[model samples]
Target: MHAITKTKPVPFLDLSAQYKSLEAEWLAAIRETGARGSFILGPNTQALEKEFAEYVGVKHAIAVANGTDSLFLSLRALGVGKGDEVVTTPFTFFASAETIDMAGATPVFADILPGSLCLDPASVRARITAKTKAIVTVHIFGYPTEMGEIMEIAKKHKLAVVEDCAQSFGALHNGKVVGSIGDTGSFSFYPTKVLGCYGDGGMVTTHSDAVDERIRRLRNHGAVKPFVHTEIGMNSRLDEVQAAVLRIKLRHIKDDIAGRQKVAQEYTQRLAGSPVKTPSLPKNGTHVFNLYTIRVPKRDAVRQALTDAQIGTSQCYPQGLHLQEVYKHLGYKPGSLPACEHATTETLSLPIYPGMPLDHIERVCEVLLEAVRG
Candidate 1:
């Protein structure tokens, strides 16, 4: 009789472990804010904006209610509205394109690079037309896009550039931080993001003082002064509680990113020579490893095997934006963007986070290998 061996289940993202690690600091900050009676856009939020701006090497940072609003407000502040077209990659979260539509602009789809899954600069150039007013570039899975080329393209066309930093809190491109390179950058603090708050929170970074002042007013119902509305705007202020929580987490972000990098290296080393194509890091950029995604055959089957073994996994996006029913009216056929469609079919995100155990990585690789071989 062989002895039974038990395997510990690995979660895709262990938010509880993360919370436990900083419970004391987070609790203290929350308690202090509650005692101060400053709930909405107060000292904590203001301080967070200042610290975040410094971190991103930007002149200003505006804290908003969520990531979507960050993008919407950035577009609106740039005067992108009806009859305008925003160019962006189709292989990303819907918000990247949805916000363009929310701003009353049409989203023009561009393909992505097969390796990095970031927008292809050539594809972006091909999409530009007379109506194109902006480009919303997303750092998918924390991999920075080729900003040098994209920036040149934007400059040639005189288009506004909005960097969607939702999945890339600390990623860098060509020795420059992502948020600082573009005209405006939007960051999300959803619980699963690289640097997240307890609840929904977001920030916008920019170097232009004019854009900064406009976004500040746009976030607060276009109020240049208290109760004085200049233009129609929605309410999207970051709460002091979430701001305090983010401030504490920001203190440990570097260490957290290091831990995630370690885990990613382990996965790459272990999965070497396997059919699975591991993430490729750019020599001139830094990847924060928000989601350690890989390309593999039989992706769905492998994902199912991992799930059956009680090891969690995810598909960051099962469908590209052009293929979504909402965009069917855009008249894009199935193969309009081959790279983006291929990515949707092949990519799978394995369990990964800061401080993940080596044993868990080994188990996931073992299960994935067996499934792939079979």
Candidate 2:
């Protein structure tokens, strides 16, 4: 296909087209649920939990209000509270580290692996102390880290592993879904995720029966029964509306992921022989390509060029978590995590959503090449 229009800026995410495609079905689901008065954690939520668990190949899936709650509840259920430390990478979104803090645990920062940009196993190993209770491995940009190595390390240290699957809803490692490998898998459905809904939603997956039960109770005010409360807990239940929306999208997750893969492949092919370094995909599993990030020299200049050319780009993260103001009390200074700090200055995410036009990809590649080669 040829360019749709060279002057038209490439969007950062084409959620509009995605919404339009399923508008009719989505409206009907919403209407049906509302008419039935199934507002709270009702049949739809129950069914979504079952369906999502099967999709992840896990024994249990608990739906929650949002992704942050998923992580917080998982940590709490895993008994990670006061004076505990959770090891995680410094390169991910704030929610990754903040959830650990919310669970009353300290977040110990680790350097990122250069290529995958996920937690470096070596760094994670070095950061562990006697107080370390768990490891949160994030699959940044839908490209999984070496889960086998992470799991092995966790097993050796008797640490709980929570796979942050927010950006990697359908991604796999060694033919198994990402969430199935960890002690508890946390996911987000914030409309832009791989298997997103119209509004906020999240899920927690686990194979341990005890963990599952604890999460279920923790998500609903820590009650053993409806009224009899035990420990204090947050009201973090997923509503029926979001669940209704998620059910429809979950059915097409495989196709949606495949579309993202196609877009990423085309971008790689088109950017060949250029200065932009495309994403380094996982060798042993599928990369669903939630974000097609590239590292280039003069990253800011290139981003400005894309903007001037009417092409949109995003900064996955502009600063490392180690240097954030809130974590200053942890006593980390600049240059502490070299790899993550460098990435903060060089990475830019290009647009790559499901059903993105070939012509759009072409225009994006053209603009990117010019910006970097200039």
Candidate 3:
């Protein structure tokens, strides 16, 4: 075994470093957003909606309170409800499946592709049945899902398709932006995401004007007027302040994605042929490197070693949603959906954000090697 190693203090995420680069501009924008006093459904929100819609190459973008709400509204807009089933990958953030349940539908688990770690279309096809009304395919870890195959299956089954692009804004599949490829594309601006705002915010992208109109109403208490309610809807609107912050961040998103790509490349070059299964990029998809994840044996020990070495690491979905007690009623066992289940035990995400330096990447690789040597 290699000798245990040490590293200088490393943070899992350095949001402050990114903020410092844009501090002056962001502060000014925040003050401006506040002064307008048009806190909700204001000019900033409308502007962001237009810009983001264009960025994703879609006709409409509906701003919502958060990512989960974006997915919920998408399901509602697609007419997904009780006695319906939405086919989804088990190897993703729970919100993908949870939104289906929130929309009064069941979430059917599907396996993921071995290479891209996105939903496998064959698995999706196998799971489809009469109850299946839609497919919610997640772009896991910023890698675009196989949209072509999934879309064909959805078309064959007459099902709606929702692209869970929360981790994959700006990513592309077959030259088309991920959000534009589905009936609705959902994005999150949580503080940690690549294109994050100052606080919680999310948006849904769609080409259908009809779906856009429904989402617009659903986000604001299902009302066309101030007091009249057309249908029961939840409160989920992106306020002006958050929208303004998003607008500022959006301008630099391409540059941010480039920087993250650099870090990911460095990690891959440094860790090549090591005892870890490095993240893979598909030939047909563009990767945004939201979180550079790897699968390794003895994940816990490596995590502890990295912690001891002052290098930060974390587990992404350490337990797959199906294995959780919350959904034990689904009757999934250890062998069910083996790909996602195996990933839950072996995956670990390393720090690879825009602001990390090459030295940090090198030290991280060195420390990881030492930890796994044991």
TM-score of each: 0.98, 0.98, 0.97
lDDT of 1 by residue, 1-374 (tens): 22223467778888888899889898898899989999999999999999999999999999999999999999999999999999998988899999999999999999999999999999999999999999999999989988999999999999999999999999999888889999999999999999998789999999999999999999998898999999988899999999998998999999999989999999999899989899989878999899999999989998999898999999977999998999999999999999999988899999889988778888888888888889
- Candidate 2's TM-score: 0.98
Q: Indicate the residue-level lDDT of 273 in model 2.
A: 81
Q: Which stretches of candidate 1 lie over 4 Å from their true place?
A: 1-7
lDDT of 3 at 161: 96
Error of 1 at 206 (Å): 0.3
- Which 10 consecutive positions of candidate 1 have the poorest summed lDDT? 1-10
Compose the digit string of candidate 3's lDDT tens values, residues 125-145. Answer: 999999999999999999999
- Writing each residue's lDDT as its tens digit, candidate 2 over 77-119 gives 9999999999998899999999999989999999999899999
Mark the regions of model 3 whose C-alpha exceeds 4 Å error after superposition.
1-7
- Rank candidates, lDDT, best first: 1, 2, 3
Residue pairs with clashing backbones, model 1: none
Which whole-number lDDT from 0 to 100 does residue 146 have in model 3? 83
Q: Over the full model, what C-alpha lDDT does candidate 3 score relative to the true structure?
A: 0.90
Q: Which stretches of candidate 2 lie over 4 Å from their true place?
A: 1-4
User: Backbone clashes in each candidate structure, one number apiece?
Assistant: 0, 0, 0
Task: Quantify all predictions' global Cα lDDT against the true fold.
Answer: 0.92, 0.92, 0.90
For model 2, give the RMSD to the true fold. Answer: 1.0
